[model samples]
Target: MKKIKTKEAVGHVLCHDITQIIKGVKKGVAFKKGHIVTEEDIPVLLSIGKENLYIWEKREGMLHENEAAKILYNICKNDYMCPSEIKEGKIELIAEKDGVLKVDIERLCKVNSLGEMMIATRHNNFPVKKGDKLAGTRIIPLVIEQEKMDKAVEVAGDKPLIKIMPFKHKKVGIVTTGSEVFYGRIKDTFGPVIREKLAEYDTEVLGQKILNDNPNEITQAIKDFINEGAELIICTGGMSVDPDDTTPSAIKNTGAKIVSYGAPVLPGAMFLLSYYKNTIPILGLPGCVMYAKRTIFDLVLPRVMADDKITLEDLASLGHGGLCLSCDVCSFPNCGFGK
Candidate 1:
């Protein structure tokens, strides 16, 4: 690119956008890239303090910032993600649907580590809504070497750096176990909480049964729900080691594979997780879930809704970020819980 005095550059093309700022009244591009510099435009350029402006000049092995930004966008954009118009050599990625955001951390780090360009994104595996800004990319200078962008793309490889997995519509069944609630001795707050939680993922509780702490009865209820086409089953209460707790036993009797009977997360340590017929997830939630606003359920539910299996190792990893601050006013999902 060639640089010339703003007053003498009447016919040259602008290589970069000259921004005009006026405190709260206005802040915008005074002369956009590729705009021909007419004699009348010289005064406008001087108003923005542009003593010298760059004119278009191509170099082999180099790319303009706008082109570099598009290359970065191409590497990160994927299904359910949309890119905004490139402005000021920057492009922002927005979510096309309400769903969970996934970022490939390793690749993202490698790309950012490459000098002269960057791509910043929202946290991975977090819930996001439509129109939410997921990521932004830009080149540091007016131009960057093409080799740098190629290296960034190579680090990103064929995998998408950002994606939104839409939540699935599944029929869920809830089996509330405990003698007090089964006999109406106490209000079943647990049932309602489980229902409300599932509803967040667009899952409907198709069938729910109130059963006392009887292994056989709990087993029968679970089998009934499966026969009724319940894709996910939840057995709340009776997961502890108390003599009357039989939810775990009942789930085992259903011949489902038990992933883990206990988790490392606080407020949900006694959580029981199992899978029926290798497809349906049956969770035996402890009493803590009824009162805690955020728990292991919040951490694991999104993965389930996205059809991602929660392996034992996955549950074990929750220990690092398991404890919730339990603020009086819960700001779950936005808080550190399950991060």
Candidate 2:
């Protein structure tokens, strides 16, 4: 860093903040550190009594903080994400649409492991809304070695390390199973809840079928929905191990590959996930989803809606933060549950 007249500092990065004081009005930083002195900022600097300023000295093979931030942003950004303007040596990624956030955890770790830089992000494989903050990138110093950022690029490989898979429109079918609802012994509450949840996304309820616990009838209903062009099938109720619970068997009978019959999540341990024709998803939701404010269904719904395939390993990874606290005020997705 070197001191120079503020008039000659245009285009140079400030090495320290310029403070301004106003009697009974305001007292704050007039110009922040790392701010590039622009012609328009001259009056502001002069008003702040900054006759001379310390600025980062430009050097070959070294990049300014904002430049390094751009490099990090390039390594992390993908479709459906927008980058915040570089500010104070930092940049943030924001979602441009509702979708599921996918993070390349392996590459992310490698980049952060390289000292003096960081890429902090939200948990991977979670839902994000439009304008939601996805990740932030910056280097620790006001200037960084260009070669170090090159290494980060190499570690990230050809593809970006972060992405937002936009939710796709889907035709969904609901199969409500249980003899109680089928025989009018009880009202069909599951269908309403499922419909309400589905309304959150771009989904068309192709149709819904209320069937008894008979595996054959349940199996036939599922097949019929698929035949009618349903892209996703949801079976609510009858997911338990009880002798009368037959939804799991019914789904399997449709020749769909079962990904997992149970998850480690509380209130959702009996959750079942399957793929039909390796494209359409078939879900057997546990009874907990009917009443629980947040469950595994909340975690998995975004992925399914985005057409992001869920693997058994994904389900296994939920055990660490799978228990919902059932807080008096529910702030799901923002909380640690299913993270």
Candidate 3:
């Protein structure tokens, strides 16, 4: 019985008899480090509750649209989806081309049928570049199956998609227009809603003023708030195409440049946006946003706070998912179209 001591182990070929393993794994199979002994070396390596051992080579960066579609279509690769369940947003089929396939969303969603329905939600016709997360079909209800996801990627023959970024936050100001709120015709709810939503981000409330919709008063309010150190000034009400809708006039009177007078978004089509001397942002909110759960304000607030340059092209992009369906079940987190 010969024993290999620690001192003698340094310069020795302890196991020369071991063979170099060349096992065939599923094309895009992966395994984390410190995983348990493998039953077979064909697919991904399994982690034994210690998942930090191996570095999983995940697909990274933005991907092209056709490339993403191909990955999505591949969900039905080899495994035939039930033909009957092909409609009703369930059971999808994709054809392979150029060594790639699209992810199968409907079929994957139906087969699992327990967790939140996974969707390959992507940016709509917005000219996505290479290595972008075009569509993410969340099949395991809310949970994404890592293995299945990797296989899906392999079938798609593209890199992993990096998550899209959300708008950052900047200081904002609120100017509640209309004599109704000033005169107590209705307990002002708009101000608080705007405040709460903005508070959810990294922004500060620069200033606030409750003024009657008098053009001069509103105009002065805009100047005072801007002078008082407000970067973004939002004037609620007085946004309609009526005589009393003095918000537009007041903002213009402040010598502010109107970026957009009306957006195509529903419940907020009458919304207004302006830049005051290029130093501040002045917004005129329509009546619908006063009590509406989600409005144009919500859609544009993040962009304003992030100091993003909003263009006509950007506003035009909101049409695809701008209307709030007001579904019985609050599908906010599940759907980001309006947001």
Which candidate's lDDT is highest? 2
Candidate 2 local lDDT, 1-339, one digit each (tens): 999999998899999888899999999888888999999999888888889999999999999999999999999988888899888999999999999999999999999999899999998998889999999999998999989999999988999998999999999999999989999999998888899999999999998899999999999999999999999999998999999999999999999999999999997999999999999999999999999898889999999999999999999999999999999999987899997
Q: Over 4 Å off in model 1, which ranges?
A: 5-43, 46-52
On residues 1-339, what C-alpha lDDT tens digit does candidate 3 reach at each position? Answer: 123432332222221111233348333223321122233532222221222222222234422222333344444334212122222123333211111122334444443343323444333222222233344332322123455555555543433222222334566778888798899988888888778777766678886788887889989988887877777888888889888778898889999888888997877999988888775778898888767777787677655654656777878868878878766676553466553
**Candidate 2 Cα misplacement greater than 4 A, ranges:** none
| Comparing 1 and 2 on TM-score, the stronger one | 2
Report every candidate's CA lDDT. 0.87, 0.93, 0.56
Put the candidates in TM-score order, highest first. Answer: 2, 1, 3
Cα TM-score per model: 0.87, 0.97, 0.54
- Best candidate per TM-score, number? 2
TM-score of 1: 0.87
Candidate 3 achieves a global lDDT of 0.56
